[model samples]
Target: MKNWLNLTAVAASVALLVGCTNNPYTGEQQAGKVGVYGGLGAVAGAAIGAATSSKKDRTKGALIGAAVGGAAAGGYGAYVDNQEAKLRQTLLNSGVQVQRDGDNLILIMPGNITFASSSANITSSFHPTLDSLVLVFKEFNKNGINIVGHTDNTGSLQLNQNLSNHRALSVANYLTTKGIAGSRISAYGVGPNQPIASNANEAGRAQNRRVEITLLPPQQ
Candidate 1:
């Protein structure tokens, strides 16, 4: 009973300490993937260690497990952080918005800048921006790329769905041509189903028509 209590206390302490960190971009305290993964790992490791070790060695086992688990999870956080920094620098003033959601990085490309109106064809001027993306993507090859196309509700559902899918495919094809591995890429379309803004006005409709490239870590 005492050994179990000790293990629980250790796990809780580690989680609490590692869970809260300052966000570099926002300069505010945010609960990020580092905290989430580290906490989960510590708990799992503690339970496993307690179950496997002899009574006399239980505490030592729990400590070692917690350390290993925390470190392994924390490494993923560092990997994404570096990649985000590179992307922000590379895409500055390029009209692409870089957003961070936990360990994932989302690159939002507005349709007006990326493709012709109501067409799947990419704009000629966007090639340079994409070229810059290719350079960074090639350098950060560890992440999986997910290309999703969204459209405003200006047409029938079927039409919007087909158009969105084609747009997503076009972006994926472009990336593949620039040396990004086909195996690392997946493209899909949500049409007007996942709009970020209302379709009642042109401004909001414009916001809805976009292509999003989300970068995922290996663990995700």
Candidate 2:
């Protein structure tokens, strides 16, 4: 049964990726969302699939469409718009960067403020930020969160991978304790596989070692 469930999860994810539309403006396949939700390990993907497979509260199809940063349309799009506005207003001046690329909402939390050097333990001071964030999650209640962990290429692949997963788990666990449903959250450690900056310098490395929590609309 477990194996069957895993297979179903992979199949569902693949179908979602393959069915994505192309954004004419950017020329990049909306399949790029696979990099966000699909790249999570099998365990995480299976958990998400199992939790969301029967959920019908939100329209998952809203996330499937053409256009990077394009306006969301229909009911699902309106749902996303309201969530985005709530996040922007709540997180204002909070140091966390909130961005909307395409249909997804990304919350970029920098490593310097979130974790200690080379450690997955969140800093003591970061709790308040998370506490505030959890309130928003409770208020929204219709979206699922994908927590992605990243690291600079300063360490071995295995080490970085472990660190990244641990960091993401830390955030997920903390949020669960603060009231976000565990089933609504999925965590993955991507390590250095995806970096937004150069790893050769301290500044860039700091930028690279970050956690991204993407709020996803409910899946069908």
Candidate 3:
């Protein structure tokens, strides 16, 4: 599987570069109207791995690959590019970290702003940020949304796992209320298993405790 991904990545990279064109209006570089459309195809082509190595992330890459077939390569890139731009604008100063990884988009909501300490309940102040995301989800309904929950290693494994699960579920349910179909969403908890920063310090732990919503564009 890894070897196949590597080969696919190489081929996709070539396709992406060849498919790209200069932005005529802004004189900026951008991917073509169509680019490599595969779950890990563009990610691999861009040399970026899936969001994180969590248990729930195991099938994320494959599902995204299968969801977006190669047929939608061109328009898929363009769609995601527009969505990413909108997300960056909406999330500006909203305390959510918006990033474009490869051809994919990730919104990282820190534990500090998302939830109170040792709780899965979202803070009242976080609602506006979510509202902005809901608008995007409704506008761009074709993307597959994956909500992954994570936490620090301070708590027991089981406790942390359950908290993570609840946190993910909370976000998923909230999105549903805003009209995003439940079918287009999947939630998972990684507990303390996948920390992006050190768990040894307060600042690092704060960074580690986060919920990542990865928007995977449909090939179409």
TM-score of every candidate: 0.85, 0.66, 0.70
lDDT of 2 by residue, 96-120 (tens): 9999976679999999999999989
* 111-154 per-residue lDDT for model 3 (tens digits): 89999988989898999889889999999989889999999999
- Candidate 3, poorest ten consecutive residues by summed lDDT: 44-53
lDDT of each: 0.86, 0.74, 0.77
**Superior by TM-score: candidate 1 or candidate 2:** 1
Report the number of the highest-TM-score candidate.
Answer: 1
Candidate 3 — which pairs collide?
A: 33-74, 34-74, 35-73, 35-74, 39-65
Local distance difference test, candidate 1:
0.86
Assess the local accuracy of residue 59 in candidate 1 as a C-alpha lDDT between 0 and 100: 80
Residues 1-220 of candidate 1 have per-residue lDDT tens digits of 4766577567656664666778787899876666667766776777777678898888877777776776777667667877888999999998899999877899999999999999999999999999999999998889899999999999899999999999999999999999999999999999999999999999999999999999998745
Worst 10 residues of 2 by lDDT: 64-73
